[model samples]
Target: MTNNSTCNPLLLGNQLCFPLYASARKIVAAYNPFLKEIGLTYPQYVTMMVLWEEKKITMHDLGKRLYLDSGTLTPVLKKLENMGYVTRSRKPEDERVVIVEITPEGQALREKAEKVPYAMGCLINRKGNLFTPEEVETLKKQLYRLIHALE
Candidate 1:
């Protein structure tokens, strides 16, 4: 009989999740400076990205799209509403469902946000950049696969 405790797969460095978690934190942190300039955080930025694309979405739908729950999303939506960037209301037909719509002010902010992707791309391609553009795309695809598998 072989005792395999010494060969444990549970070791910190041997687990896949550690690197994924660390990398996710690093990538989000990378957005801080630019997001700070625009008065947004990484979560807020991504929420706006989806809202920008969808125009208006039910809170349930937004939560699904963002892989977030209402508990996590409600405050972000509320903050955006307070910032005059969005409006949230209960749907008349179904009061249980809430609708979120970007404001005209939010529409105007899109022009300002247009440069954000380019700026982020530049950061991703900087001298010490961890991955090439192609590699980054590949990693994104792989991560999406992992996400789907987990789901």
Candidate 2:
């Protein structure tokens, strides 16, 4: 009945998920100062990113794109709406469908956010970098593959 490290499935070090979770937290923390200056939390920033690109999209599609459920996404949308950055309204033809669109203010914020990726890139890929730009791209592709597979 002796415990063996190789056979210990419950060990934290044996879980692939731990590093992924921790790395996501660290990356989000790194984005905090820039996001703070923009007056958005990370979730809001990501939501706005999609809205900026799509200009308008349904709530269902936004949730699928962001990997968020309505329970989690609703509040984020509400806050963005309250900030006058976005507007959410029911579709006239389909009451059950809610559409989200970026407002003029939200579009203006995109100018401020334009610098965030560059700043984060410098932080992550400065001298003695943890990952090269190529490595980052490769990793991102791999992660997306994994996400698609999971879905």
Instruction: Estimate every model's Cα lDDT from 0 to 1.
Output: 0.88, 0.95
Candidate 2 lDDT, 20-62, residue by residue in tens: 9999999999999999999999999999999999999999999
Model 1 earns a TM-score of 0.89
Give candidate 1 regions above 4 Å deviation.
1-7, 128-133
Candidate achieving the largest TM-score:
2
Return the TM-score for each candidate structure: 0.89, 0.92
Model 2 spans > 4 angstroms off: 1-4
RMSD of each: 3.0, 2.4
TM-score of model number 2: 0.92
User: Candidate 1, after superposition: displacement of residue 29 in Å?
Assistant: 0.9
Error of 2 at 123 (Å): 1.3
lDDT per residue (tens digit) for residues 58-129 in model 1? 999999888899999999999999999999999999999999999999888888777888887789878677
